[model samples]
Target: MVRRRHTGRRLRSDESGFTLAELLVAMMIISGVLLGLMAVQTSALVTTAQTRQRAQGTAVANQVMEQMRALPWASLSKGMHASFASAAGGDPNVTSSQLHPVADPSITEPLVTSTDQTTDRAPLSGAGGSNKTVEADPSIPGFTYTSRAYVTRSAQTAANVLTLTVITSWRANQTTTQKHVILRSQAFAPTGGCGDASNQPYLGACQALLSGDAGATGPTVTVAAAGAGPTGPVTTPTTPIIPGTEATVATLSVGTAGVGLTSQQATAVEATATHGGLQTLTADAAVAAVATGGGRLTNSASNDAGSAGAAPANPADVTGVGSASPLTVSGTGMSLQLVPASGTSANLRATTTVSCATGVPAGQACAASDLTGGGASSVVLTTGGTPFTVASVAGGGSAKTLGARFTSAAGTTAVGCAALSGPGCLGTSVKRTVGLTSVGQGPWTGGAAPSGLASVTSYTDATLVERGLSQRTTAGVTTRTGTVSYWNGSGYSTLTIDRLTSTTLVTPAVTTTVGGVTVSASATVTVTPAMSIASHPDPVGCSGQGCSVTSDTGTLTLTVTYVVTSGGIPSAFTAAASVGSGRASAAFKAAPSA
Candidate 1:
């Protein structure tokens, strides 16, 4: 066959392969099919990896539960459990750190391997990836897991029942799949609610204790050294149970023991590390609701591990109490001498709180400046999660919102980097840091710690806050008042925190006439924090008092008014009132001054 072109050129059958338009169309069709296939394959691979990891997580959680069951009830109730690790790199036999859900050049492919099951792990810094397959050693697979446990008293549930939740976190791939498989169980008072009819050794002791039987010889109860060693109530006869004083102690009561107890009732005494009032619920002995991993939040493939999990307590105090006094700030103006947990808190995302004593304010935080001065400075950050809104909500959904001052990823720097942080003992075996910095149009000028930081984790009375005034140092310290305590979660005894202010105040005297009479009046203004530590409740005391912190009421409003004097009595003037606004928080004192 022969085909003639538009220009009248003739093409023979052998010479005619195809027209340009036809060839182009054919290529496009083939490309579309190939792309579709590729997409399907990618999806399948990701799904397969995710499913495999989740299954492994479930198994690990179950294994932890088994360990808890066999452990002495006292040890389980202590609530200190080790975190599980996953195999590090290619060598499937030894376990290292389970990679965080961020791309790491060190890890070949984030997967669960054989050694990841609690025993075969290395440290956080030792793993890099290798080309290995689970098929080679059936025990080795690509999925990795981290197991965490949280044991606490069930809310409004029985006192004898403890909720043990074993959490398993697994990562299939940083970009694809990461999930937590939770397994929960309830451990009852081994002595059968301490209500068992049998004359159990503690039965008599519990009856004597609960019945207020003055004649009863009570069991010896003791608080571990600052509450480090504690033996719960359900131990054997020889190791009779006792009470501890460092924490809240709850006791189990028998249903029939109170007024109508035909016999001595069973009971279990328990203690835990929560500062709130003791919890008492009258539910049945075995009543406990289990989440069993049902509650889940699957990241949108874009959320990084750092942001995916609950943000670890915000490390905002720029200053530490080295050998000096504790850190304090008055309102948003003053900066703390927060020592880098590693070396320098360079690029860590943080905000200075003015009105946020108890917590941070919504749109208020976005307006804060960075920590600068001293040895450190506030470097500008462009990328990170927005912490608070104009309404002061961490996960903001408010009428008013304040954009973060420094919100660029490029601004983020690495902490403890030899090249970035410069020499000295840069936390090699101590901490992990992703340093961040931002100046963000801040009015705050940061400073350095006067003394060196503690060699280890130690709590000090160093953080001190003076009431409202206008100076960072004791020079301008205002009226020191009020007793406040903040529980710093890391095993420290309750530390006393005083509300101090570093902001200056001005009061004015004015005279206004209402109703044709000369009047002399002075406006009294008392500064109340738009938000303070008392305003919000946080069980986990932290440095920054981050996300979960409640929002602050916007603006401190001072009402102004002049009263009308009728003869000798002062009458109110509604229309003559005046209103003014100030910062939403109070000044906080950080230390005794370096």
Candidate 2:
């Protein structure tokens, strides 16, 4: 504990004065301390500024998330940045990314935010507050605050629920890495519609769905395909809901019901009306038109099978009557004659008095023309005088038919959507009563041979035929019956369709199906991801860490929530939502070297 002092003058070794080297060393240490202190002060100031910006960014993110949570499910669509400049709820990108099926895309004032705002929003007042915030920028001294929102189904595990994530970001400093503050929330599409209708998107979507069931004649409502993108919403059956007596075939179930369904999947409709404690059942469908009935020809007992039916034309002695087996007469001048229609004449009568289909009447002089039809074989009457003129009949192919056999199938074919949802599709049954296209032969074409064994050369032969067309063809119908079930989300309903009861018989098109209720080729609804994206300067925006370090290439993931169930058909089904989004970017990076 010895104290030493030094004067301004240089001193001897024993005088206790400091050396030049010691002074130099002390000066060097002090200079180093001062420089270090200055550096520490500068660093602390920079750190404080960076921390403030980050805090502001986090606050902004929480503010946005709180605001989003208050919105309806309809607003939880895939998108990035949207400006609240107009009533349009949609920028081109926001519009294309809408989830719910709606017509007017008026984005309400609250859903959109101003990218040019100067203040950070308080957690309570999301619009804005006194928290000072910097404009989002990637360049130079000051930090920039940028924000964005993303919606996706892939990130969510619940049905009828969507994930909404708000990301607020800023650069720590000119040389520091960018930072981000992310806040996430969820929105659900409730049973009533648009998840309670808090915002315009939710209200519009819910109203649109209800409007789809408008104009129906009954209280039971059928939820059909609606809006743009997809149709034929098989999510719910066409129930007697809304405001009619069509009957409540079924109702929506709890938890989850129709999961994956669309309009194309609605193969049938079932309705039940209770009267006096008894329920009357009705089941049918409306589909596109398919070809139905046709005709075919067939023969009956008159086709000359085993025994001679009723009466057939009997060939007698006539020179011109052509028959496979006929009675022939000799003498070149002899002509053919015919028996009267009444067949009671004992003597020959005038040509007009007696009637025969193939021969001249009795009494009239036989003319040379009467024999003209007799080919190589000639038939002459054994009782007739020689040189008399008569008529002749030519023979041709003969195989008579009864008419159309009425070839038909059990089920019919059809297409199109039923009445409901929106202006989707409609079809006609097209009960085309097609004509008899072709004819088939049976055993009608035949001729009588004498039981006494008289040959064509021996018996008088005259050409006589019952050929031409003896039967008519007609189109016929084939009937079929079966049972079907309808699951309207809540319960099941059974129905029966019978052709016998024309009134209850299915008159709707697209009714024919082999298995269960109709199934859709694709989902009745679809939510497109972010589209039509663009970059806006601070007072503009992008994504991730501030507009400077992030890019709003305008891409997004979609999460659609819907339900489907077995609508009491042979096979129950569901409707599944499709998501099309992941980590996508237009930013360039160096190729990874192996």
Candidate 3:
């Protein structure tokens, strides 16, 4: 078969092989195909390495962001992880302006700044370690990466929101461009920018607290010491502090005091002892007392003393100290002065009885056992070796009061309210008797009349008069009044005066002819406006323990003039007096003797 195939196929020499140019072209084509494959593989390898590095860089950025997120509002500042290591939250009393790291208090807006990177170390593993730069690492296996994190406060999102950004950079090769991976996140500050109250008084903000529920928490709130008064620092837990039921939030030491708490809802405020300390509460029932009697949180030592001067022989007509004749008076005069022998601040006392609530049964009344006394009576004041007895009342919810009844040194004549009640001293009618002396006497006319008795005179004489001490208990308040008067033959000349209400009295000038003598008199009085205190709940926040009472404020003032014209001559006497103003607060301590 082989011999037969050879005999049939005889070819020319030209067809057996190719030309040299063609051969060269074929070789070139093969070489190009192989090179293309090699190039594609190389490109793929490079791409994979780049993707891995990017993932690592992104992870580093994420780590930095998380670190910043864990920090509190106060600690997450320009510093990195260890720069501001404090765990303290924002101080409520300290505003952002006051607390910023920089001295610029006006910087209210947030600024974007690079975090401190000096203390941070690269987390990547490399033989060159900390000493190598990304560009210096050969083979790119030891490429060093650098990370930077920036924090910015974004008001557009929220006042307390912070935007965190992290950028991780590295170089693929010595001549390659820098590549970076960025990651962003956000964190929120506590509501109201408040932190734990244990730090300091931050009541200015974060005043409201979260309700008391299981697993519930809120920022700490503090009551700071400020102003002139008995003041002490008070800090409370995050939970709501039930006044009286819980521990005291603050204590005012004996000699110190605190200013009013601004803008608080019904909250309990307290003072340990009485002194000149005054704690005024601002806002609706914001300043409340935990003491039993709705008493003020203050203290004082001196009683209401008239403008410094000597008292008349029978001042205020309360003490029957003057002689029988109005012309020549010599005896111990009425002195409205109280000096506590022990020099203690235990002066005023009170007792309260609440009425039936609005929704109580029609026939049922409040019980006597419901009486709540401010304190047991003690020695409050003494004058002329005789201590004045304080008066007590019952069954006045808010108008109940304690007062003193003045009597002569011999205990003969007395001037003052008989008893204290919500309706005022119900059974008492205060009367002042003044014995006046005849001035500029006129000769008796031939018949039944004195000479010059019909003449009239006018004068606006200004003179300092003796302070008259008068106490009137009306509508649960005890007002001390000073009156100007002169001694008459038998008693004070009766004058026309009207008391329209507990707060108003009308006294008009008058001229009268009695027994051939013309006498003209005029009197003036000043009263401070009544304090309109709103009704509030006991123990604050409607704790339902009982109702609370309000304290009272009062002033004393009076002016009087009396003139007599006889025998065409005129003699005038004027009296002007003012007693110091005082306030009566609820008493929770021992009451002085009544």
Name the best candidate (by TM-score). 3
Segments of candidate 1 deviating more than 4 angstroms: 1-17, 81-143, 174-178, 190-594
In candidate 2, what are the lDDT values of residues 1-594, reduced to their tens digit? 987876578767798878999999999999999999999999999989787777777776776666655432333332222332132232222344442212222321123233443222222112332222234444344656755554545322565556665556565665567676656565655565532444333443232110000000000101112221233233244432111223222111000000000111111111111100011111234322111111111111111122444211121222212222222222222212221111000111111112221222222111111111111211112111212111111121111000100011111122111121221221111010111110100111121111100100110101110100110010112121323222222333333322231211111111111123221111122122222121223211121111111111111111111111123322111212111111111111111110
Tens digits of per-residue lDDT for model 1 on 1-594?
899668776878889788999999999999999999999999999889667656666776787666555443333444431322222222222233332222222322122222222221112111221211121113444545665444456445576566655556654565455555656676655545333444232233222111000000000111011111132122322220112111111111000000000011221111001000111121233533211111111100111123443322222322211111111111111111111111111111222222211222321121111111112111111111111000000110001111111111111111111121100010000011111110111111121111110000110111111111111111111111222111122211222212232221212323333333323222222223323232212223211121111112211111222222333433221111101111111121111100
Candidate 3 residue-wise lDDT, 130-242, digit = tens = 21112223336667676554455655677656666555677764347777666667655444454334322232122221110000000011121111112312323421121
Error of 1 at 315 (Å): 70
RMSD of each: 30.7, 38.2, 34.2
Give the local distance difference test score of model 1.
0.24
What TM-score, to 2 decimals, does candidate 1 have?
0.22
Off by over 4 Å in 2: 1-15, 77-143, 192-594
Q: How high is each candidate's TM-score? A: 0.22, 0.23, 0.24
CA lDDT, every prediction?
0.24, 0.25, 0.28
| Candidate 3 local Cα displacement, residue 344, angstroms | 73
